[model samples]
Target: MTQDKTNFTSQQDRLPPQSIEAEEVILGGIMLDPSAMSRISDRLSADAFYINAHKDIYQAALRLYSQGLPTDLLCITNWLSDNGLLFRIGGRNKLASLVDRTVSAVNIDVLADLVMEKYQRRQLILAGTEIVQLGYATETDLPVILDEAEQKVYSIASEHSASDLVHISHALADTFTEIEARHTGKGSPAASSGFYDLDNILGGGFRKGRLYVLAARPSVGKSALAGNLALNVAKTGKMPICVFSLEMSTDEYVQRFLSSESGIENNFLETGNVSDSQWQPLSVAIAQLSEQQIFINDESCPSLNEIRSQVRRISSHYGGVGLVIIDYLQLMALDTDSRVNMAQRVGEISRGLKRLAKDLDVPVLALSQLNREVEHRNDKRPVLSDLKDSGAVEQDSDVVIMLYREEMYNPDTPDRGIAELVVRKQRNGPTGTVKLLFDHQFTRFKNLSRGRSF
Candidate 1:
C-alpha cells in the first residue's frame, strides 16, 4: 500500500521547499487559473496588510463586473486599494464582516484525497490542465498571456540566431503588407501646396509618420523650412496636423507661419517692419489659421514618452492627428534606460519615430541638424553621411532627404531663392532632386508647378 501510494502520487503532491512560500510556490506550479496565482504571488512580494486570493475575483466582479485574468486581477486590486481595505487573503463585507483566512491546499496528494469526497474540486484542476501542459496559455481567460511573455523575452534576447528567423520573417512580411496597403494612391481632402518639385519630392505633401529632416549649418533656415511645412499642412483643413516645437515658442512658430501665409516676411515680423496695411492681412491670416485644425506644442526638451503621450492626448481630443511635426529629432531626450552606444541610441530614437508614424498612421516631419562635414565638403549640399548618428537611422528610415540651397553658400549665386530638395535615400522608390521655391522674406515653400499650387 505504501509503494502503491508512492507510485500514484502526482507532481503537485510534492510540496515546495521551506525556503519559498509554500502556498505561492504550489499555486505558481499548478495548471490552474494564472490570475488566481498572480494575485497570491503579488500579495506575498508586497508588504500587504492582508491577502485573499479570491479577493481579486470578488473585487474584479465589483469593479469591472465580469473581469477575467490579468484585467480582472488589476481591477480588483485597484478597487480594493481605493476603498481603504487591505488587499489580503481574507475579504470583508460592505459592513466589514470578517472572513476567516483559509490556506489553500498545497499538496496535490492531500487535495486529491479531499476531492475524492468532493469531485467538483478535482474537475476544476483538470479543466485548464491542457493549456498549461502545452505552455500555450497561463489561464483559460488569458489565452494571450504566454504570447506576451514570449515577446518580452524575444525583445531583449542576446542571441537571435538561425532559429529566430521565422519570427523575424513573419513580422517583416506583416509590415510589408501594411506598407503596400498604404502606398496605394491614398488621397487626402487637403489642397496640395503648390511646388511640383517639392510635391513630387514629398510624394504630395508632408505626410503622417514620416520625418522630413531639414538639416543645415547653424543659420540655414531649419526653423524656416519646418515652419513652412507646418503652414503647408495646416492650410489643408482636411488633413489636420500638430507641431511640437522644442526649440521655438508657439508664438515664434506662429509668427513664422503668418509671415509665410500673409507674405509679411520674417525680417519684417522680427524687426517690427510691417506697415498698418500688412497688419490687416496678417491679422486675417491669424484668424484663418486659428480656425484650422493645426495645433502647436512648444514644450522644450520633452522625452519621447512625453511626446507620445501628448500625441495620444491630441489625437484623442481631435478625431485624430494626421501629421506630427517635431521641430528637430536630436533635441528630444531619451528617458528609457539604455546602456547602448550613441549610434544605437540614435537608431533607437529613429526606430521610435518610425514606430510613432506607424502607430498613428500618419507622416511625422522632424527637422535635423547636419554635421560640420557638410561645411567641409566643396559642395555644401547635405549628404547621407552627414546625418547625425547611427547606421540604423539610414537603414530604418523609409525616406532620407536633405534640404540644400547653393545660395546659402554663395549669396551672389543666381538661384538666390531656389532650394534643392535632395532625396539622398529613398527606400521604396527612386531617388531624385525636386526643386522648391524658398521665399527668403516669408519663410515659405510653394510649388513652382502650375496645377499643384495651393
Candidate 2:
C-alpha cells in the first residue's frame, strides 16, 4: 500500500502537458516580427504558455499589439516595466534572450498551434481532475454531478478551440457554392416552417443555430403552434425532431397530434369517444405520425442540463437533429442554489437554451408565457417586453413570435376563430402579423384562406 501511494504521488507531481519550446518560439517570433501577431493572435492566448514568465511576456506583447504599437523586444520590456511586471517576468534580460534566439516569424503559426494543443491537453487533464473531485462529492445529487462533469469536459473540447478568421474572398467562395446548390435544388440552408406566409416572413424558415421564442398568454395556443411546427419538421423526414414537454404528458401530446392531423375534436380524442366515421381518420393520422421520426420527453420541470444531455444523445443517435422544441421555457428548472432568485434563474435558463441551440447546430423553438401586463392593456397584444420572468428571453432569442387571439379577448369580435401570430421581433427579417385560422376543437392553426370567413 505504501509503495502504491508513493507511485501515485510521483505521478501526480509530474508536470502537466506543455511545450516550452513552442511558447518560447511564439513569444520570440512575435517580438522579432510584430506583424506575426495578427496570424497567431486568435489561435493562442497568454495562458497557452507553460511558464508564468512566458505568460507575462506574451501578455505584454499582446497589449502593445492591441494599442497599435510595435511588439519589439524594447517595447515589450518597457511595457512590462511600466506595468511593474518586469522582474516578475525575469527582467529585461529575458526579453532580449527570446528575440536573440529567434531569426524569423515564418513558423510562428505552426508554433502557435503546437502551444494551443498543449494547452488543450492540460485543460483536459484539469477537467478530469475536477471530474474526479465531483465524483467524490457524495452530498451532491447524481444528476447534477453528471451534468457538471459533462459541461466541464464539453467546454474544454469546444470553447477552447478558437476558429481562425476567414478572408472575405474565401468566405465569398463558400457563399457562392451554397447559392449555386440552392439554385440547383440540391440543398437549402434553412428548414421550412411548413407555413407559406410564416416561411416567407422568416426569410425561408428556422435557420440552424438560432433560438426562436414563442410567447403568449394562457390558452392562446403557443404550445399548439410549437407542436404544429414540430410535426411539420418531422413530416419532412429529413431530420429527427426532439420535443421536451415539461407541462404536458407524452400521451396528451400524441393525442393532440392525432386530433390535429385527423381534423377531429381534441375533446373527443381525450375522452376516447371517437365515432365510427372518425376512426378511419384517426387510424390514418396514427399511421402517418408513426412514419415520422419524433422523440418526446415528458419529464415535468426538467433541469436544463437534463434536456441538453438528452438532446445530445438523440442527436447522436439520429445522425442529426433538425429541431428541438421546449413546451415552455418558464417551467424548465435550473439547478441553482438559494442565492439565485427566480428572475436570475430564468435568465440563466434562457441563455443556456440559446447556447444549446448553437452547440447542437440546430434551431430551438422555446415556448414562453407573456406577463400579465398584456392583459391590463387595451390592445392585449404582447410585445418583446411581455416575455415573463426575465428580459433575457428576448435578448437571447434570434426571433420572438407572440400569439394573439381576438376571440379570447373579445368573444363578439368579427375576427372570432382567427389567431394572429404577431412577429414582434425578427433578427434578420421584417416583423409583421400573420393571420391563421384556429380550430379550437382540433387544437390546431392553419393558413387562412383569402376568401374564407369565420
Candidate 3:
C-alpha cells in the first residue's frame, strides 16, 4: 500500500510556475508595516500568490484593511486561528517564520511585482496548454477555437493591467486641477476639434475618456468630417491620433487628407491634373502631415478585440493615444454570439467601444450611418432616433452629433456649402447646432467665418 501511494503521488506530480519566496516576502512586508499593503492593494489580488496558504493570508489582511481593522501579525494570526484556518495554513509557526525572515517593507514593491509576474506566467502557461489541446481537438470549429483562445490570453493581460476605482474626491481634485491649468493659460480638459464654434458648443473640446458618435445619412460627408477632425488633431502636436479605417483604405484616406490640408480639389488630385501653383501647397501639406503622429489602420472589418490590441500597440509606441477614430460603426465586426439580433449586436459593439475609451483614457470618435427614415421626413435633419441598428449608440455615447447639409436636399437654396453640425445630445454641456463650410471640391469642412459666404 505504501509503494502504491508513492507511485500515485509521483505520477500526479506537476511543476506549476511560481515564486514562493517572493510571496512570503510580500506577506511578511505587509505584516511588518501594515501600510505596505495599501501601496499595492489595488495592484495585487488574492490569485497573485502561487501558494494557497499565502493567498489566504493576503486575503485576510486585505479584509482587515478594508474594514478599517489592524493588519498586524497578532491580529491576523488570531483571526486565522479563530476562523479554523490557521492549521490549514501551517499554524502559528509558519506565520512567525514569515515575520522573522523579512527584513523590512521597503522592498515590498519589488516582491509584489515578482509575485504578479509569476502569476501571469502561470496563467500564460495554462492558456497555452489549453490552446495546444484545442489545436489538436477536432470537435469545435477552428475559427471559434482560435477566438476563444485569444479571448483567454487577452483577458489575462487585461486583468493584470486594469485600472482601479477612484473616489469622487480624487476625481474632483483632478477636475479642479485641470480647471486651474486652463485658467492660468496652461491647458484644457480635452483636445479641441479645431473648429472654434464647434469647440465652443462642445464646452472646450472632446473630453478625455468619452465616446463621441458622429452620425449622418449617406452622401452627407460623415467620413469627410471625421478625416478633417483627425487632421486637425494631428496638427495640434499635443498627442498622437490613431484612425481605424474599416471602410476606407490607407491610400484613399491620405489623398483626402492631402486635399483638405493643401486646399486642392479632390478630383484634381485623383486625376493628377494639379497646376504648378498647386504643387507647392501639396508638397508642403505632405511634409507637414508626415511630421505629425497620425497612424491609420485600414482593416476591412476589425473586431473590438483587434481594435483594442491595436490601440494598445500604438499607445505603447507613441507614449499614448490622444484620440481614436473609427470611420463608421457599422463596418466593425460585432464581438458576440451570432444568434443575437442586429440591434443587440450593435448595442454590444457600442458598449464595448465606450468601455474601451474609458479603459484607454482616450476619446473614441466613431462615425455612424443614420437611418434612411430621415429622407422621408419634411425637415430631413437627423435626430437621436436616426441612429441605425441600435438606440444604445445614442445611450452609450457621451456625445451624439448629426451632420446636416440643406444644399444636398435643395440645390437651389442660398445656403450652399453650409453644413450643420447638430449636437443633439451632450452629457456634460449644452446641445445645439453649429454651422461650418463644406468645401466639397477639397472634401473638407472648415469653421464658418464671421462674414464669409461661399
Put down candidate 2 lDDT per residue, 1-454, tens digits, no spaces: 0011111232476766778877888888988899999998777888778788888888888888889999988899889999999988778788888888888899998888888888788778777777888999999989899988988876776765446678999999998997787677676677777776887688667888999999999988888888888998777637899999989999989988999999999999878888999999999999999988889999887788888888887776787788999988878834454488877877888899999998878899999888899889999989888889899888899999999999898999999989998999998889999888898888888888442110
Clashes found in each candidate (C-alpha, N, C closer than 3 A): 18, 0, 0
Q: Which runs in model 3 stand beyond 4 Å of their true positions?
A: 1-22, 29-43, 103-110, 121-161, 333-342, 450-454
Count backbone clashes in candidate 1: 18
For candidate 3, the per-residue lDDT at 203 reads 70
The TM-score measured for candidate 2 stands at 0.70
* C-alpha positional error of residue 306 in candidate 3 after TM-score superposition, expressed in Å: 3.0
For residues 234-320, could you state the per-residue lDDT of candidate 3 as single tens digits? 776468889999888999999999998899999999999999999999999999889888889997877787788778767767877
> Ten-residue segment with the worst summed lDDT in candidate 2?
1-10
> lDDT score of model 2?
0.84
**Which whole-number lDDT from 0 to 100 does residue 294 have in model 1?**
79
The alpha-carbon lDDT assigned to residue 141 of candidate 2 equals: 86
In candidate 1, which residue ranges exceed 4 Å CA deviation? 1-194, 206-212, 334-342, 452-454
Query: Candidate 3, residue 324: CA error in Å?
Result: 2.5
Ranking by lDDT: 3, 2, 1
- Per TM-score, the best of the predicted structures is 3
Which candidate, 1 or 2, would have the higher TM-score against the true structure? 2
TM-scores vs. true structure, each candidate: 0.57, 0.70, 0.83
Give the C-alpha lDDT of model 1. Answer: 0.57
lDDT of 1 by residue, 1-454 (tens): 0011112124466531122133233322222323344333322222111124433333443344334334323444455667665344344332132111223324533332232222222222333353355465435334244433333333322111213225778889976875565466454322343455566555565555565455566667777776766666556535567788888899898888788778787788988988988989988888887877777888786666556666765675676776787877666634334576567776777788888776555677667777788888798887888887666667767777788888877989998888877888765566788777777777777655565422
